[model samples]
Target: MFCYQCEQTMRSDVQDGCYTDKGVCGKTAETSDLQDILIYQVKGIAQYAQLARGLGVVDVAVDDFIQFAIFTTLTNVNFTSARFVSLVQQAAEVRNSIKDKYLAAALLKGVEAEVPMGPAQFDPAADMDNILKQESVAIVNKDHDIIGEDANGLKMLILYGMKGVCAYSHHARMLGYRQDDIDAEIERILTYLTSNPTDIEDLLNQALSAGHLNLKVMDLLDRANNETFGNQEPTQVRVTPVAGKCLLVSGHDLHDMHQILEQTKDMGINVYTHGEMLPAHAYPGLKKYPHLAGNYGGAWQDQQREFAEFPGPIVLTSNCIIEPAKNYRQRIFTTGPVGWPGVRHIEGGNYKPLIQAAKALPGFKADEEEKTITTGFGHHTVLGVADKVIDAVKSGAIKHFFMIGGCDGAKPGRNYYTELAEKTPDDTIMMTLGCNKFRFNKEEFGDIGGIPRLLDMGQCNDAFSAIKVATELANAFECGVNDLPLSLMVSWFEQKATAVLLALLAAGVKGIHLGPSLPPYLTSNLLAVLVERFDIRVNGTAEADLEKALGHAVA
Candidate 1:
């Protein structure tokens, strides 16, 4: 029952430990066990996808299965025992269907050729460890497929990142951002999970390949976001809380965000973005509303403190919901798959519950006059300043770029992010998104050419912005992304960060320094694959890492 896959782990050290005692995140022990099992089974699906890719068999259903597995793992989505069990069973069925049909065909072909491909051995109810071990092997080098703890951690990072990507990709798909090649890779990863290879070296290679495939997925999503939604532009928003009937919107659903923005436009209900929703101000469409306000607080982990004083109802569009506090009690509305036992859920873009709750509450009174925060400097906005950026680079005005954002949590060690931001060289620019940005967003980092040293690039979902900026920087510099003087120091707290990591790998951005901690769910085989291909490393002290990043040895 151990789990610390997010930034919310209670442990002080970043050794990937978890405090499963008394249920962190309000997940019961049984539910935690079920989620572990579900993750294990999905690894099997990842094996199957990898194997199918090796066989040149591409299928769409397999892609859907991968997305569903990730979505099911998202925060605050499926806490009920029954729903968790149903998801595990559903994953098993998908694995069985893919394996049974494929195995039968291979065996029959072998028998007809007097070659007997090997005895058909496929079972869904087989030992769970065996499935996970096999899945681990599929992502590693086939010639050397044994996995260790580090490798496992790396693989989990990549897979979970892909899961996060799939969630956003799904949303973009809703907005018409579809790419068959990305879908195929998802299928390939899932199928490969079913393979039983034990070669350590080979398994490691497969892990790198997974990262490569993720690059394609990220690119597809980037195009979807920019082409469909328009590039980001600089904008500012107010942070004052709305009184009376207020609706707090959280999560990464741009569609739901837009819907709420529209529904509450004239309803006297003020809408404030929470957690991942803070980046909504970067969008041209959503920012048009005069009623849309600034971010409410930090990541989902801070809800207990941030939601305490709110006077109105809150609507969660996705994951990362903390156990409700008394102030927000009876006023929380869950949307999409996000659920809490007593909270109301609004399904399928439904706003009736949100509207009703908004009306039922006393309605919003302005907590204070609008206080503005600068945001909306995503890739597009950066590129728009392309000429100025290029000039600054040539003049040595901007020496280094640091992408210092990811999930934020309640853990004590997360303060390192804030410390690092505070210590960043004044000449360097820090780009951030996600709740992690809360650490430094309020700091007094002066601007370079009117752009704050702490630049808000949108949400974790908008890691797309980070990727786009990196790629564009490489293009502008006429060198590979690795050649740019940019460093990535991120803190991951959920599966969405998983997808962003994969995207980074896919783009061949190597030697990333990650931390606050590593995920507790990964196995060694996966980490080895990452080390071999991407040279990924965990973060150390902020001063140490910052010095290292700046090419300065200990003084």
Candidate 2:
């Protein structure tokens, strides 16, 4: 198996991906192959779904399945080969059902519906062994020889961007938000990939289109969260653990977090947010639960150590789950798109099993002293004070704005973000989101006047908030976003970050400094295109990049 979709992918001078029995994330070759096959089947579903939509027939179930299947294939989301096998079979069934709908609609219209070739018409084998042998068609690099590396790289970009789209869309759908137009566009992009187009310009444009699509999905999710849980406000969240029975809920699902908070209410089990769920504390609806305790640990990469040390049950609500260690394996539970071979999974939003596990385990021995950090400076809160911010900018009280955040990983060189945040001038305001904030969030940057210098904007999806704030600031300054004294230093990990990068480019934001390393899938030619078009820069030393953004030599 071969995979290089994440920042942690194995890389060397001679090799660019994980080509062995297991990947850096502990995903085995069999699991990787199964995920590939599942995606191929989802492509088949998209083939039919796109045609059906063209005939004025839309199946929400098919669209939902498309989002879910793609989301599960995201790095570190699901590593269960058996689960992927089931998903592959389920995808085929969903595709056939949609195919029947399309055929019936075409028959009613008295039009000949031509069947699409490639994945659209391809059939999978009955068993996992036979399925694994179908790598010729399922492998990501299958077209590397025929299409050349550059075009293949662009195709992978589009595919990975779509994965990010589906991940965001899945979260919105879970919150009971549905948009037919968004669903149609998702199918359109997936169907476009079935053709194996190699035109460099068109592939890049389509990749950017995925970015635009992601912007819409992010906006939908933002609205979903705000409308459901109330708009986020500035709130102080305790980062230290509290005493009593507790359950640590991680990942980026607010709905899951809310469910756990509700079910475990008054049950003597304290629910603590971890990882991306750190933003949940700012939501009024969720924070209303007194039993919703503080956060535990940092980002996803450090979970193995953190989870083992935490003295309560752990619940994974979404992506970024690693293989569980024996220390907490029995006490941890997986839900939503996250899964592991032996970990118990919570189905249908049920929390009884998870709550029981928490009850059975010994929680924290005693309550730790209250130590807190600030979050929830989303677009709404920031823009609400637009006048003050603009005034500060005019008076030179706020010299610049640095948006330094993205997915965090266990790789080296990530300390660049910490140092970058630290070196940001005292007069500048730092806006951050995603798990990457764990790097420098604890460090005190104080505030510029009344506004905090370091602002924690929600999760990775909340990159939408940054984009909105930038656009608003541009409008206030009567200039383009790039013309403002702002810089985007993005550290990407998986497909979600890819989608976010595309969105920034699609929005015409330029001069983004991206690292720890460029994607291995991107050939130098493709990288050249991005640099020439978008002014994208590989991150240098934190001090060097900070000086470049500030246009000065630091003392």
Candidate 3:
């Protein structure tokens, strides 16, 4: 198996990938192989889905399934091999169903159907072993020498970027939001992947175009979250457990969290948020639940220790799920796109088994001293204080702005983010989003007059919020977003963040500082294009980057 879609991908001057029995993200060979087959078939489905769209036969279900299937294949989302195998077969069936629909529609129009000769016309193997045999020609680098490393790397940029697009779109779709333009664009990009293009420069341009497409996906997701939950408001959430039967909901699926909260209401159980679900407390619709307790744990990486110590059933609703540990193995649950080998998966929006597991376990014998952290300072919350923010900057009360947001990882240099946030001057304001805030969210940064120095935007999908905020700020100042007194110090670990970065570049938001490590899939030449075109740079020490952000020249 070959994969290099995350911050932890194996990299060096000479090589940039993970081609082994296991990936750094803990994905096993069997699961990775099945994921590739699923992607291949998804592309085959798209080959027909795109044509179906052109023949006046639009299938919204097919489009949603395409996004959902690609979302399942993202890093650290689904690790169950059997599930992927099933998805592969389902993909082909969906493709055939759509193909038939398109042809029938064409015939009814008194016109003949034109069938494509590639994936649209091919038959996939029914079993796993023969499916593995197809990998020789389907792998990302199958034509590496012919296209060279640079072109191959650019292709990966588009492929992985779209995976992120699919991930965000899937979350939005779950909440009943989707645009045909965005859906068709995602299908179009996947169709491009099936052809195996080789022009280095052309592929690079397409990658940037993907950045443009990702902007729309993020915008759709932002609207879905805000319109569904009401805008986030500044709220203090308790971290210490309340005395009661406890159920911990992790990952970032707010829809699942709401459903669980609804089912478990008045059941003598206390629902607590973990990891990315911490932001749920800020949303008015979600926060209205009386039983929805406070947050627990730090970030996704700390789950091994935190989950083992928790005294109740833990439900992972989305990505960033690790293999379940023995301490709480039976009590652990998976839902939505997240999966594990032996853990129970709750489907059809049922919470009985999970609620029963919570009742069976001994939860929090005694309440710890209550600890509170401030969150919910998303676009709505921040912009509500726009007058104060503008005055602070106009009066030189707030000297500069820093956007230290993106996905989090367990990599070594991750501590750089913690240090960078901690060392920011009292005069600077920090706008943070995603799980990366786990690094420094616990700390008290006080406030700049009335505004908190550190503002917690929602999750990774809130990149849309960040972009809106920056654009508005720019307009307020009569300048470009890049001209604002703001700096982007982004920490990315996976494809969703990759898609967000592309959105930033597409919007002409420049001088981005990206790290804890560069994507291994980017060849040096491709990196040069990003550096020159976007003014992108790998992160240096927190001390050095901090100085740059503050306008202090360092020798």
Best by TM-score: 2
Could you say which candidate leads in lDDT? 2
Candidate 1: lDDT over CA atoms?
0.68
Root-mean-square deviation of every model: 5.4, 0.8, 1.6
Candidate 2 Cα errors over 4 Å, as ranges: none
Summarize candidate 1's per-residue lDDT along 1-555 as a digit string, tens digits: 555556554555544445454356777655556566676666666665555544555556766766755676665565655565667667778876766555655565563211112111323334444433343222222222355455455455545655666677676665666677777666555445444444556555565566676556556666666665566777777776655566788877777888888877887666788877877777777878877766777677778777766656787767877778766768888776566767777777768777877778775454677676778887778888878877877888988899887888777678888888888887898998677887778667897776567789877767767887888878888999888888898887777776677667766789888777666554455556567778887888989998888898434
For residues 86-154, could you state the per-residue lDDT of candidate 2 as single tens digits?
888888889899999999999999999979877877677888998788867889988889989999999
Tens digits of lDDT, candidate 3, 27-119: 987788778777877888888888788877889989888888888888888998888878878888898999999889888887878776566
The TM-score values for the models, in the order shown, are: 0.82, 0.99, 0.97
TM-score of 1: 0.82
Native-referenced Cα lDDT, model 2: 0.91
List clashing residue pairs in candidate 3: none
- Return the lDDT, model 2, position 506: 92
Task: Please give the range of 10 consecutive residues that has the lowest summed lDDT in model 2.
Answer: 116-125
| Clashing residue pairs in candidate 2 (N, C-alpha, C atoms within 3 angstroms) | none
